[model samples]
Target chain A: MAQIRCTDLTLAYDGVTVADGIDFTVNAGDYLCIVGENGSGKSTLVRALLGLKAPTSGSITFGDGLTAKEIGYLPQQTEIQRDFPASVREVVLSGCIGRFGHSLFYTKLQKDLAAYHMERMGIADLAKKCYRELSGGQQQRVRLARALCATGKLLLLDEPTAGLDPIVSRELYSLIEHLHKTEKITVVMVSHDLEAVMHDASHILHLKKKQLFFGTREEYLDSEIGKTFLGGAGNA
Target chain B: MLEMVFEMFTYPFMLRALGVGVLVSLCAALLGVSLVLKRYSMIGDGLSHVGFGALAIAAVANLSPLKVAIPIVVIAAFFLLRLSENSRLKGDSAIAVISTSALALGVLVISVGGGVNTDLNSYMFGSIYAMSGEDVTLSLILSAVVLFLFLLFYTRIFAVTFDESFARASGVRVGLYNMLIAALTAVTIVLGMRMMGAMLISALIIFPALTSMRVFKTFRGVVISSAAVAVICFVVGITLSYLLDAPGGASVVLTNLAAMLLFSLIGMVRKS
Candidate 1:
């Protein structure tokens, strides 16, 4: 069953059209990579799917016992967030804010979840370290841990490897691949790297201003839209 | 020195000033951590200028200044937030535009309606001597409300201050908490304007957070230490002004600055 379905979605910023007539379905346990060029509204589409922004006119329906609030999101980090003064523990623990409901403080259960995710991310030792002091790879891992504490069922990452070196990017992809294959967390990601787009992605949703293509990785690699992005190397 | 300290609080005005000063300082410091983190620290300055304008109009119209200023400043804070959200202006630029224009309007109100009065001195540059018994009562009630709301929303505030987008996606109502912070800050700044003065009140909001940030590595640590530092500085500043016949607002600002410098030195030593 589809976990999330978008129909006839159009996104705009201040009346300037961003993307129009976009449709996609994220099936349960599917690894969907949203690939697009710069200014092609991949991030915007991510925002709309996460319910952070309302599409100009369309519906984002959640099914399979899933809700928008239950989705774990690793947002693209901004400069202010990068330099924020928070400890690794605090950052990860806050992912349980939604679970707290009206409670003023975190419960022991939430703390344990945060700790578990920290261990999973290999940053358990750095729980007390300030987030701003961590390296880029460490920070992204910390963020992934935080997102996991939100929901270990479905994870959404936006440009998780935007600034990392090739080695670190590969490591992050491997970590994500482990989560997808071993833990069975459905993964939806927005990334700029067309080269890294094929690996582990069950499906790809390539977005542009007017055209959007969503299909299996194999189908995408065979299509002209994917050829345009993946280039001739898609065959190799 | 102990007797002199005891003597200062014996007077009703000094007692009111100490009570209100400490209360406002604590609120300002608590909110300041988030404000500084969000890079919206200067919003306090902008709102105080608006408070000054409202006070001037209240004086001319013969209304209670606190009553008049609080709502206007709160609305301005909300307006500024809206402006930043919808308009192209950033928080700092919106603050600059609103604060300067309000300050100019305040000057206009004072000059056109009634030439500089003794009241203007106390309002523009605050005086502990100017705090009335009525002001003390209002400050007491408002301070309690601010403290209550802050503690109640502590978790939400911490989350939003760290990463608003993540918090929002996590189902935290970022807008509601942001408004609560803005309104609380507006009230704190207005009340503080009576003791810290319109010109210097933002210093109350800025100093403690910056000082604590220099020494503390975590948000909770910074918040707790900032509040402690604000209260201590306000008390010392009040006492110093009373003893030295100094302007109360300037005295408090200087005390905060000294504490900030001390924290900076400690931070340097630790790093070295």
Candidate 2:
């Protein structure tokens, strides 16, 4: 059974239709990559998936006992974070905020979860360090650890390596790949890194203001849209 | 200096002002950390301006200023939120427009009604004599409520301030928390405006947070230090006001400015 399924999803904001007729499903443990050009509604689709924005039409449903809150999310860095005053551990612990629901403080279980994720992400040593003082790659690791604290079932990443050196980006990608392979966690990533996507993803969903293609990675490589995107602008 | 300080505390009005000042300073400092982080620092200034307009109306009608200002300022805060979120006005511009208009309306009303009495001057510049016994009690209660709500939602506010999208994705009600911060800010502004003055009340919300951020590397450190900075500044400012017979609000603002400069110097020295 699919962990998440979207049917004929149409997303529009500010009276403008950014994308329409989007249909896809993620089976448990599937590695899905959403790819698109700029202004192609890729981020919008991510928002819709995360339940941050409502679709103008169609339905998104979770199966296999998956709830929306159970999805771990690693969003792109925002301007506020560039100078934010927060310890690494404090940020990671915030991810467990959803687990308890309106509780005043984190429990020992949540703290333990955060600590474990930090250790796994290779950021346990940086736990007491200020977040703003960390390097770009380390900050992403902190955020990835924070996301891991939210859920263990599935992970959604939107441009997780948006602004990092190539070596750092590769390291993050490998770390995510390691988590996916070892933990049996379903992964949905939005990315502009076509080479990485081709190498890492099991499935591809291409968007160009609409659903251009949705299929397995091999199938996507053979599809006309994927061939054009990969052969023309994408690094083949 | 010790005897003079001890003597200043003996007066009932000084004691009342001190009590209200401490609570307001604590509340402002707590909420200020989030507001400054979220870049909503000017909301305090904007709401205080709205409070000024409301106070002008209250004074003209012989009603309690707090009674009239609280709801209006809160509504203005919500309006600022909505305007920034939905309208083309954006954040800082919306604040500028609304706040200036409110300030103008206050000045116009004050000029038209009574030709600028000492009562009106006190609201604009803030005098220690401005706080009455009833006003002190009301201010203390409202300040306590502000402090309580801020503490209750501290974690969520930190999450929201740090990252709104992640907070929303984590199933945190980002909009609801944003509204909570705005409303609490509104109440704090109205409560402090009587003593801090409408023009300078925002200093209470901005200076301590910025000062603390200069030296503190973590949010918890900044928050704790911000509260301490605010209280110490308020105490010193009020003392200077009593000694030099300066305006209470101006004294406090200058003290905060000095603290900010001092912290920045310390931060730079530590870096070197």
Candidate 3:
């Protein structure tokens, strides 16, 4: 079943339309990578899908018992945000706030879930360490653990490997690949890593300022636009 | 020295001032962790200037300053939050524009209302015995309100302060919590300016949070440490001021400065 569907979606800012007439459907357990050039509205579309902003027009529908609020998100980090004063454990546990509902406390299950995700991300040893003191790769892992605690159904990552070394990026990708395959969590990622993501993603969303591409990986590879963009080898 | 301090508290007004000071300091610390984390700590300073302007207006209109300043500064806090998020006017620039203007407006209002009055100096710089019975009652009630809301939304506030966009993406009502912080801090700012004066109120908010963050690695730890630090500084500052004949507001701010310096030294030494 489709986990999320966007129909004729239009996103704009300050009365200027960025992307319009967009249609895409992400199926259950599918890893979808949203790719685009710098100015291409990938971030805007993510914001719309996450309900952070109202679509200029059109709608996004969710299925498979998934709601917008239940979707986990790992946002791109800024320098100031990176320097925030918080422990790795506290950062991960905060992801439970959405499910915390009206209660002012974290349940044992929530704490256990946070602990589980931290262990899964291999950062359980750094749980008590300050988040700001971690390396970029370690910080991203902590953020991933935090997002995992937010929801188990769907995880949306925005440029998760933006500022890491190539080796660390590959390691992070492997971790994400493991999560996608083993945890069966539907993944929607906006990333600039064309070659790295294609091998892992089940579907590709190639967005241009005026064009939109959404299909299975093979179909996307076979498409003329993909051929032209990738010069016939998306692996490159 | 201890007996001298005990004897000063024997007076009803001194006890009243101490009670209100303690309440305001605790509330400021609770609100401060988020404000400092959000980099909105100066909002207290900005709102206090607005409160100062409102206080002058209240005096001119012959109304209670607390009644007048509370609503005005609360509204100003909302505006400040909106302005802070506005791209063209973000962070300290927005605060500088609003706060300096309000400060000038305060002076103008005071002059236009016929020069500096007898209580104006007390309001601007704070006096230990300046808190009246009515002011004490309002302080207790408003402090309770601020403390209760802070506790009620502690987790949500933590989420919002840490990463606003991510928190919003995960279904936390980011705007509502921002407003809650602004409102609570506004009330605390107004109460604090009356008890510790405008110039020192921001110190109460920023110092405790910064000092706590120096020692604590987690949000909850910082918050608990901030409250403790704020109360201790306030008490120690008050005692020192009484003993040495110093200004109460400056005394508290200096104590906060000392605490920040001490904690930063410890942090550096530990890191090394």
Q: Per-residue lDDT tens digits of candidate 2, residues A52-149?
A: 88999999999987888889999889888999999999999999878867578888899999999999999999999999999999999999998999
In terms of TM-score, which candidate is strongest? Answer: 2
The RMSD of every model to the true structure, in order and in angstroms, is 2.0, 1.6, 2.0
Write the candidate numbers in order of decreasing lDDT: 2, 1, 3
Which pairs clash (backbone N, Cα, C closer than 3 Å) in model 1? Answer: none
The CAPRI class of candidate 1 is medium
Candidate 1 residue lDDT tens string, B204-243: 8999999998888887888899999999999999999988
TM-score of chain A of 2: 0.97
Model 3 lDDT per residue over B179-254, tens place: 9889888988887787788777888899999998887877888999999999999999988988998999999999
Report per-candidate DockQ.
Answer: 0.77, 0.84, 0.75
Model 2 lDDT tens row, B1-62: 78888999999888988888888898889889988997777778888889999999888777
User: Model 2 misses residue A205 by how many Å?
Assistant: 0.4
Candidate 1, position B56, lDDT: 90
Models ranked on TM-score:
2, 1, 3
Task: Please give the range of 10 consecutive residues that has the lowest summed lDDT in model 3 chain B.
Answer: B114-123
The top-ranked prediction according to lDDT is: 2
Q: How does model 3 score by TM-score? A: 0.96
Put the candidates in DockQ order, highest first. 2, 1, 3
Q: Which of 1 and 3 is ahead in TM-score?
A: 1
